[model samples]
Target: MLKIVKTEILKLKRYHILWAGIALMLLSVMLTLFTSMANDGSVWDFTYMIEQVIKNNMSTIFPMCITLITGYIITREQKDNTLKNILTIPISFKQLLVGKLLVCGILSLFLGMICTIFTIMGSFLAGFPGFSVGLALQAFIQITFVNLFLYIAVMPIVILTSRFSSGFLIGVIVAFVYGYCGMFAAGDMKLANLVSVKK
Candidate 1:
């Protein structure tokens, strides 16, 4: 499994889809910055900025973004005609799938860090008040863990899509709707609890 994960990482070294994922991560921060321009007179600070970024992550960006990327990775074996070669090496597709899932968990953490960096940069650029080392550290930990949990939430979709060729495209659509629903759920405690367990 470790070897499979390492090989998957190596394959991703040149994978252009990663750039798309990074761009999506950047889009979350960009959206947060754009929201900061509102004249509603609400005070904006580092902590609030981090909160909004995490909100956007959960409500808009991370779930679908990670799902899309994970789906691509899972289906690539079929897309590139490499499954046969991979299977010939004495590994079952089930094992390969598990390895791919593990790789995605790790990838989610790395992307989380990237998102944190972008959030901090966005905060600085937007002139958010009350910046502090403690807040930054808190943001880092929160965003990174939130990403991992979000990835976990979307894992079933990735696994389902992996069973079909190019099914990840469908997973992307499902993930977007799935994530968007969270915004509505958060408004009601009952709905939020139901949705939390549903995921």
Candidate 2:
């Protein structure tokens, strides 16, 4: 299982999937920055900026990013013509799927860290009022974990998409809606924090 996971992670080293996540992170921060122009008199601080990045990640970016990345990795087994070779080694498709999913879970954390890095860069670049070393460190931890949970929340769609060759795009759509629905559930005490708490 660890070997399968290692293989899956190696595949990602050649794939540019992280670029998509980075792009989305930048866009999320930019969108938040654009909204800040409304000037409602809210103080912009490192923590506040982190919140905006988290909001965009939970509601817009992380879901589709992780799903699409996972789906592509899964499907590439067939596309790259390696599935047959892998099966000959006595590794079942089920095992392969599990390994790929596990790798994606790890990938989600890496992407979360990337998102946090980009958010901090965006904050400093835009020169939004408040920033302190302590605030930045706290925000990094908070935002990164939030994004990791956001990926976990969209796991079902990732699994669903992995079952088909042409499901990546569909998975992206489903993930977006699923992530967007987090907003509705977030207000309910029962469902709020469900993403972070559930598997």
Q: In terms of lDDT, which candidate is strongest?
A: 1
**In candidate 1, which residue ranges exceed 4 Å CA deviation?**
197-199
Q: Give the per-residue lDDT of model 1 (tens digit) for 1-199.
A: 8999899989888679999989998999999989888999978999999999899999889989999989999899998999999999999999999998999999999999999999999888888889999989999999998999999988988888888998999999988888888988877888787555123
Record all residue pairs in model 1 with backbone atoms less than 3 Å apart, i.e. clashing. none
Best-fitting candidate, scored by TM-score: 1
Q: What is candidate 1's TM-score against the reference? A: 0.96
Write down the TM-score of every candidate: 0.96, 0.90
**Each model's C-alpha lDDT?**
0.89, 0.80
Poorest lDDT segment (10 consecutive residues) of candidate 1: 190-199
